[model samples]
Target: MAKPKFLIKTWGCQMNVLDSDKLAGTLMDLGYEPTPSEDEAEVILLNTCSVREGPENKVFTELGRLRPLKKNKLKVLGVVGCVAQQEKAAIFSRAPYVDLVMGPRSIMHLPELLEQARHQKALEAEFRDDSVLYPGGKISRSHPVKAFVTVMEGCSKKCAYCIVPFTRGREIYRPLESILSETREAVDSGFTEIELLGQNVNCWKDGATKGFADLLEAVSGVEGVKRLRFTTSHPRHFPLEAALLMAERPNICHYLHLPLQSGSTKILKAMRRQYDKEWYLDLVRQIRSRVPDIALSTDVIVGFPGETEEDFLETLEVVREAEYDAIFSFRYSPRPGTPAAKAEPVAGEVARERHQRLLDAQLPIQTRRLKAFAGRTIEVLVEGRSKRGTEWMGRSGDNKVVNFTSTGQPSVNTYLQVTVERAGANSLFGKAVTAKNEAPGAKCKA
Candidate 1:
């Protein structure tokens, strides 16, 4: 008999991606094979993200489309991750067909929960600091080259506009030994890049390792880890040592994703971001001075309660002054159960207008930033083939996507030198340079 098929639709950050991988690993161990087509699966799970309202809505929209698949068959449907934790028992009422609703922590119980879901709906949303054990096993991953290891989970910060603190709960650091063991095992298993993930990765601490910088140093020391990266850092928790480490460590990608919610101190204080515009600018200056070539990216929310025209203009000024290589900008949406939800929102048109202006302000910066790579030779880890057979897709150490046509097969995970021929706002077009002329970092990480 053929094995049952399973499909997972993951939405959100790298943390959710890592969760979906573990979920898939568990299912494959249970004798289910993965199918890319949702229609062909005996089971489907929507591993969701709830950090932003937009992603949360997309999850429901997708579920609505998938609900019809359950009309006449014994199909198992599930919801996992942040949205599952936030919605809890409420998701059952919203979508009665969902069999299992497991939070990120409930991943350890996945095999048992799927077994129990046959008789009745199962819900596991409770937060436990130690519930997520460091998973150690031989399992298939979506990506053969890169992997994400959760160094910690949850956020201790109480930023007023944020719901992560409520959904993921307090910060809980995974034991350092387990993390080192897992990373070493991944290197042994042929993985080269390891991304440490957490809500506020910089805030992680385990016994003597009181800061992310220390943790990063320890992991960077692990042999065979060609590239190391982490994400979603709040400016307040990012210490100077982390900046210094990025400068000194050649393997650590030269990229910083420090979120700057607003440029107006009033709006920032209202959002409880803890750092004012001047403080953020000073930090950026210090970092740039330390690591001049480091690529900078930020998160910006265009509209918030009581944000005046002046406040919006201040944001525009910051975008111009900061000169970010890229940005993830969004029109603010009030999330339920947050303090900002009760506050009067900016008019929709005004918010939309500001959002456009914010994008307009960043266009020149991004254009100029991307153009800087037009004449340079950069090392990229080949991710896979692009739409064109002759073109292969890859990312530079700074995480910029570069597409290049190569004469050779250029297998995934091999590092190749791509001397840029043209640049676009979001990605670069280039031709692969042969081994003789490869850049210093172009050694295939294996």
Candidate 2:
């Protein structure tokens, strides 16, 4: 008998991407094959994200588009991830064709759920016991150079604007030894970079690894790992030691993505982010004191519930003061069941205007930042060809995208020192300064 094929469509954060990967691994374990194309698959899973309004809309739009597949003899059409957890019964009500609805907590029970859904309906969103490490086991890795190793699952912080807690449940840390073992396996597999993923990564505190700082220190010691990084840290729980560790460790990339959702102290208090503007600025000061040229990125919501123009200005003030390398700015979109949803949102045009203002404010700063790199030589971890394929592309240790034409086919997963010749709005144009095993200013080995 031919094995059944599955396709997982993921929309949202790195955690969702990793969850989709886990789903793929789980399906493979159950003797199901993965298909790159959706039409050929007998099973389709939508690993969702409900943190923001945009991704939530994407899920429904995609489901509507895939409605025809239900009649194509598709065995399973499941909805997984944050949206599944957030809109449990409503999904079946809105899109009656969906076969199964499982949240992050239900991931490990996929095979059983699939079997059950075959005979009867299944919806598994309730938080399960934390005794088992979530998303357990590792069967395969798709990337040759980059890998996202989830050190923990879920979020304990129930910020008013976020639906993560409702979807992902409480925070649970994976054992430190499991993380170390996985890092070693990636190294043995020739992967160079390991990105530690979590909703609030710096909040990690397993008994085996008491703090995220300790986890970074341990992972840095893993041989063959060239670069180490973590993501989506909350300002409230971002440990001081983690910043210091980033400064001390050469392998840890000098990049921090701390989300300062709203700049106004009152708005922040309303959002229950647990950190004020003063605290955020002070934290930024402390981090820059440790690594002065550290490339910083942030997530900003321009308008929030009860947000005033004054509040919007305060957000702009923080953005101007912070001078981030990039900002993922968004207009506040009230999500279902969150406290913020009940509150009156900023007027649509007003929100859109503020969103544009935030982007506009960041534009000159980002452009200037990229321009400053011109004539400076920086190490870039080769990713692959640029979009046009006329040039090679990679990221510097600071996480700035650099694209340059090479003499021959560029090798991925290698390192190169490129001196910036020019700058674009968000990326840099450069020429080779050195390649792997070559001295500074030496000709690149095609």
TM-score of each: 0.93, 0.93
Model 1 lDDT, residue 369, Cα: 87
Query: Mind giving the per-residue lDDT tens digits that candidate 2 earns over 314-335?
Result: 9999999998999998888888
Q: Cα RMSD to native, each candidate?
A: 2.7, 3.3
Those runs of model 1 whose alpha carbons end farther than 4 Å from true positions after fitting are 71-75, 122-125, 136-139, 387-390, 435-446
Worst 10 residues of 2 by lDDT: 437-446
Relative to the unseen true structure, what is the C-alpha lDDT of residue 159 in candidate 1, on a scale of 0 to 100?
A: 75
Clash list (residue pairs), candidate 1: none
Residue-level lDDT tens digits of model 1 in 143-254 = 6568778788888887777777777778888877888888888877766777887888888888973578888898988998889988878898888898899899988899
What TM-score would you give candidate 2 relative to the actual structure?
0.93
Per-candidate local distance difference test: 0.82, 0.82
